[model samples]
Target chain A: MSDVRAEAIELRDAVVLYGAHPALTGASVRIGRGEIVLVEGANGSGKSTLLRACAGLKPLVRGEGRVLGFDLRHERAEVRRRTALLAHRDGLWADLTALENVQVWARLAGAAPDEAAAALGRMGIAGPLASRRVGSMSAGQKRRCALACVVVRRAEVWLLDEPHSALDAQGRDDLDALLVAARAAGATVVVASHDTERVAAFADRRIVLSGGRVA
Target chain B: MTEPLATARTIAAKDLAVERRSRVVANQVLPFAGLVMVMFAFALDDDAIASRVAGGLVWLAALLALLVTVQRSFAVDAADGALEAIRAAGADMRGVFLGKVAALAVQLLVLEAVLVAAAIVLYRVSVRDPLLLVAVLVAATAGLAAVGCIYGGVVAGAGGRETLLPLLLMPVAAPVLIGATRATESAFASGGATPAEGWPWVGLLAAFAAVFLVAGAMSFAALVEE
Candidate 1:
């Protein structure tokens, strides 16, 4: 068992259910602060659920879990406040421009307004592209916009699901660089992705899940 | 921690911005409401009867428009999981509820104005008490928007939300429809009623609005979260 004080994420026998069916059976994981961990598994292997559980987005049916010293069961709002979860869906308003979308998220996260522009620029979405509506943008552009929103928040824990699926080669490289910078900044990164080879170089560790338990 | 009121303001501004860009309310809901009033005029086929029932028709049009506005408001969030993202980002859900109610109320008020104008032009109804009419419009629109948002959040993310929203909203909204229509009839001085008679109904509308607004604010987080 990892020392609770040193860990950024710790889950013990966490079980999550969807109605009567179990999505996460008895998963347990421990990662120290500022570690970049890649979560791998098959289609129904509960990889996404593990990341969500760490982010406090999924309730633990039967286990003890904590992220950044916040209890997963009771202090979910605090966990959410300190973490950012990028789900499969980009979670952006299609009608809003990329800049407007990032600005709104930045304001919600209480970040400085200039951070919105800087984040977008960091994601390679500057100039006219920033003003373009998300509905009109290509899939890769939209993904980059979504990444900008995530970047602007500057959360301590980043739970990214399929973070590389829609990005082009350049966008993927940008994302890799962003991850490296995040680690250097002392943020914990837990990414659930199928591209193991791409993430293998920088990921400090790999945890595979099968039937909802860590394998 | 972000102040809840500030969060509410930001969300309200964002929602309004989305509406301004999408034009769904202007292009779709407003025309649908105008068309409903025209259809009512055609169905009545007599100026005397249409004028007699103009207040009821106006409120009815507002009710239908409320349904469309509520559905469209939630649909935008549901389309991209924006609400989930907002919640997961630790936004105060009560603020979200209030912001949505404010935006929906604004949209419904605009729809009511057009419907009232349509009633005057098509049904030849004259407003006997403009103050009473305005009071009824404000209170009724607030009540309608509150009720619509509560039910809208409940049914959001469900399959068939488009159809489920009306099914769940109409029955709950019956009180708003009845209260607004009766109060508006008095405002129009239809059926020999006076503006004095409408004050009580306005009180009822205000009470209904207050109750739902508080309830929605308290329950929105639970309703939206998984």
Candidate 2:
């Protein structure tokens, strides 16, 4: 088996569509280890769709791409197993406490949290609310809990879709530091965002998207 | 960081623990399942119909209970951003699907136990072969939960989860329901485990579970992101 550590996400003429509506044109790029790439575009400009394509979340209904050497069409599971994606909604269980929420993803990500509290602590989520149900959390707090998921899993690649949204200044700084730490650890990072100012310091290159085409 | 079994177990455990703490399953689902069964019993009361429909009654209770629980399964994960995180962390969607199915399976078993116990007490329905009946329960419940897990993903993405869930789930679930009801009827009629007569229906339920599970697990990542 090739070392998973050495792998990178590669996109070549990758196209994605929702029925007849094209979300990504024949776009191509490669993201390598230790690289922090920023995907900047207006809403519905294919920033999210690009991340989805490379992660094998979006099907390459036409054209082709390789993520960590697995063809997006034939080996999606292999591609997905090596990539981590964060999205806009902070998709979480409102009924679960912040700690339980992260623990669930940690388990699903094949990471066991000996102490979920410790993970929460690292994400700057402490005190009584750490155990509070997600439904009661502020958007920033929920995003913090969502960020804790990456810490627990510690995957090689991170595809963050608007990771800085709904955060106050402190939360943005914390996330920036987290992204820096991830890159220092040799993890590949990609951030898709319209808020370029918040993510600028961490990017190795900025790929701009407009009208489903790379600009 | 952990083995897949441990990971799946933890995901299942977290959901189970949270539900236990909140008593959501007991408060919301258990009563509803029991009520559905009792309603059926009352509708079929004081007639030879109760005994005739007992098998269908059990299958019906399981189907309804599983349908309700499956939506809860995805709703919990989707709410916490846990689904996106799991997908991001590159956890096998199959493993995640299995974890969801496993959690729902446990919930279904508990609901089934309550309903079955209630059936015996309230309706005076009795199984001639307790062990064989337990086997039937296990097979049929697995079938229901497996199909439910897949449609749960589809319903999670739809606009109306509560309305859409049963719509998507029932069509896929019909084969298993029919098989389980037929197997139960045969069991009741024969008063024994008759493989020649009962196995085909049981086999159909088993096949439905196997086929959908593989298809569901394989197609899960696609469905969730869409």
Candidate 3:
């Protein structure tokens, strides 16, 4: 009823179809700016779809939605610019070094070189480790490097899917702090994770999805 | 320049830089083109190959190389989710398409230059209209890059893309192959067809480039979207 302008993400009866099958059906959600929201759902429950939609990676085939005051479909590109989605794939190039990967993201987001370096530092990637090719790094290290990319972006919205899957204990702790920091910095955070308890302490709200609708 | 253009430049730089590091185009495609030229020389008499068949050989070599290079453009990005990351960055989709076209066009043009020189040397082809040959090369390369970019995006996430791409690409590329070959033929033809005949084929090549460049830019977002 109130102004949807200020909301970070607003959706009503949003539908995302992959071929004939709807991955997200009649989904409705409202997340305010700077709030940490967690999406809990089973494997086929459309957790990734919801996050992807929020980041404007998945377009709404039906219904209506707005991400950061931009239409979820028509203004999808703009929405994606403001939001960052870290999916199951770490999205790191194998031939590129950790620093190069982070730098690429920083450049895309128009962030400064120092900021990218600092983001890597925050993720505990430095010295020789910073220059190591992503393929050569351990899975946890690659995850950390990718998290560093998210950190450097400093986007308005953060959409993370299965954020804790390949993370070490320290990496998980760092991720938790990053979520808290992003929220405190006035960025909306939506995390889709099966390990809900790990992020529960910092989450401002919890949403559970079943059959593509809020349960 | 606008942000999209800047982003496009960055993407192009990254792609070209990667190719430089990998040497895929240099070591693999370039040599492949040379070998194809040599094999053509072996099969056809040099006297016949020089003026008459040389154009066809050059186009065929470039076409094969285009298939490999264009496929790599998407393959590298697809593996790392770099394409997804780019889209998420909110860089203009058109800019992404243009950036790739520019990078691939440059690489292709470089390959074209070398192959043309090789055709001239190995086959002893003389240029009646050097300018026309250059024009055909430029226009054809643009068409190839634009069309390749579109299909590259289309097959990014699809399975069996390595095999799927040539099947999807070769048919559509027929116009380019015919147009470029004919244009090249008319360019150096002493009496094969009037030089005027070559201009129309060049026009066709230009039309192909323009049509596909616009199509790729308009449809790029839909093609790459998950």
The best candidate in terms of DockQ: 1
lDDT of 3 at A178: 84
For each candidate, the DockQ is 0.74, 0.45, 0.51
In candidate 2, how many Å is residue B206 off? 5.4
Give the number of the best model, judged by TM-score: 1
Per-model TM-score, in order, reads 0.97, 0.84, 0.90
Can you tell me which runs of candidate 2 are displaced by over 4 Å?
A: A1-13, A30-32, A61-64, A68-74, B1-7, B45-48, B79-81, B159-168, B171-225
DockQ of predicted model 3: 0.51
RMSD of each: 2.0, 3.7, 2.9
Q: What's the CA error at residue B134 for candidate 1, in Å?
A: 1.4
Off by over 4 Å in 3: A1-5, B127-129, B186-203
Error of 2 at B124 (Å): 2.6
Task: Say which docking band candidate 2 falls in.
Answer: acceptable
The local lDDT score (0 to 100) that residue B73 gets in candidate 2 is 77
Considering lDDT, which of the candidate structures 1 and 2 is the better prediction for this target? 1
- Residue-by-residue lDDT tens digits, candidate 3, B1-226: 1276776776787788778767889899999998999888877865764568888888999999999999988888988787887787777788789889999999999998999888888877766788899999999999999999999999988999999999999999989999988888777673375566798899999999999999998889878878
Give the C-alpha lDDT of model 1.
0.90
Query: Per-residue CA lDDT of candidate 1, range A96-132, in tens?
Result: 9999999999988888989999999999999999999
* Clashes found in each candidate (C-alpha, N, C closer than 3 A): 0, 10, 0
